[model samples]
Target: MRALRYLALAGLLATAGIAVAAPATYQLDPTHTMVLFSWNHFGFSNPSADLNNVQGTLVYDEKDPSKSSVDVTLPLSGLDTFVPKLDEHLKSADFLDATKYPNITFKSTKVSAAGKGKLKVTGDLTVHGVTKPVTLDVTVNKVGDHPMLKVPAVGFDATATLKRSDFGVGAYVPNVSDEIKVRITTEGHAEKK
Candidate 1:
C-alpha cells in the first residue's frame, strides 16, 4: 500500500511539471530584422523606406501558439530612404518628428494560429506618440537550428497596412497617399540558458 501511494504521488508530480512547461524565449537578431514601408508618391511612383536594426524579444510556445508574445523596438534614427535629403526630411518635425519621439514600438496583446505555419498577431503599435491596435498577418518562415550560428532560431515574415494620419504622421496626405504598406522580416535566436 505504501509503495502504491508513492507511485501515485510521483505520477501526479510528473503530470504537473508537464502542464507548467514554460515557453521558449528568443532574442531578435538585430542585423537580420528590418521593417520596410511604402507609400504612393503623387500617383506616379511608390517610394519606400527601410528601418533596420530592430531589437526585440519573442516568447514562443510551440505546443500552444496562442501563448506566444512579441515586443520590439524600432529606432527612428535607423530610418533610411536611400536619399540622404529625404532621410533628414522624414526625421524632421514635419513627418515622424524623430527629435521629439525617437522610437517606435510594438507589444503583442494576443497571438493566434491562423493556419499551418501562419499566425495572426494583434498588438499595440506606438508611432509618433500615438498608440493604436494593429494586426499583422504573419507567416512562419522557419523554426529550427541555425546553419551557421548553430543555435535554435526562428524566422517570420509579417505584413500590415496603416494610415499615416492615424499615427499623426500625415504630411502630404492625398498627394503622397496616407495609406502605408508595411512589411517586416525578422530572425531570432534562442536565448542562452
Candidate 2:
C-alpha cells in the first residue's frame, strides 16, 4: 500500500509538471507596429495619417484561438500627417484633443477564428473619453522565431472602419467625411516571464 501511494503521488506530480502551457503573451514591438487612418476630405480626396508609438500585449493560443486576447494603446501624441501643421491641428481640441485625452485604447472581449489565418476580434475601443464596441478583421501574417532577435514573434495585419462621429471627433462631418478607415500592421515579441 505504501509503495502504491508513492507511485501514484509521483505520477500526479509528473502530470502536473507537464501540464499544457497557457497562451503565450507577447509585447508589442512599437517600432514595428503602426496604425494608419484615412478619411474622405470634402469629397476632394482621401487624406491619410499614421499613428506611431503603439504599445500593447497580445496573448495568443495556437490550439485554441478563442482563448486569445489583445490590449493595445496608442498615444495621441504620435499622430503624424507628414505635415506638421496638420499634425498639430489633429491633436488640438478641435480634433482628438490630445492635451486632455492623450491615449486611444482597445481591449478585446472576444476572439474567434474566421477562416484559415483569419480572425474576427471584437473589442471595446476607447477614444477621446468615449468607449464603443468595435470589431477588426485580422489576418495572421506569420508566427515564429525572429531571425534577428532569435525570439518567438508574431505578426498580423488588421483593418477596421469606424465613424469619427461615434467617438465624438466629428469636426467636419459629412463634408470632411464621418467614416474613417483604419489599418494596422503589428509585430509582437514573446514576453519572457
Predictions in order: lDDT: 0.93, 0.94
Q: Which ten residues in a row have the lowest lDDT in candidate 2?
A: 16-25
lDDT comparing candidate 1 with the true structure: 0.93
lDDT of 1 by residue, 70-159 (tens): 999999999999999999999999999999999999999999999999999999999999999999999999988998888889999999
Q: Choose the strongest candidate by lDDT.
A: 2
Which segments of candidate 1 are over 4 A away from where they belong? 1-4, 10-21
Query: What is the RMSD of candidate 2?
Result: 2.0
lDDT of 2 by residue, 62-178 (tens): 778899999999999889999999999999999999999999999999999999999999999999999999999999999899899888999999999999999999997899989
Residue 92's lDDT in candidate 1: 93
Q: Over the full model, what C-alpha lDDT does candidate 2 score relative to the true structure? A: 0.94
Could you give me the TM-score of model 2 versus the true structure?
0.91
- Candidate 2 off by > 4 Å: 1-19
Look at candidate 1 and give me any clashing residue pairs: none
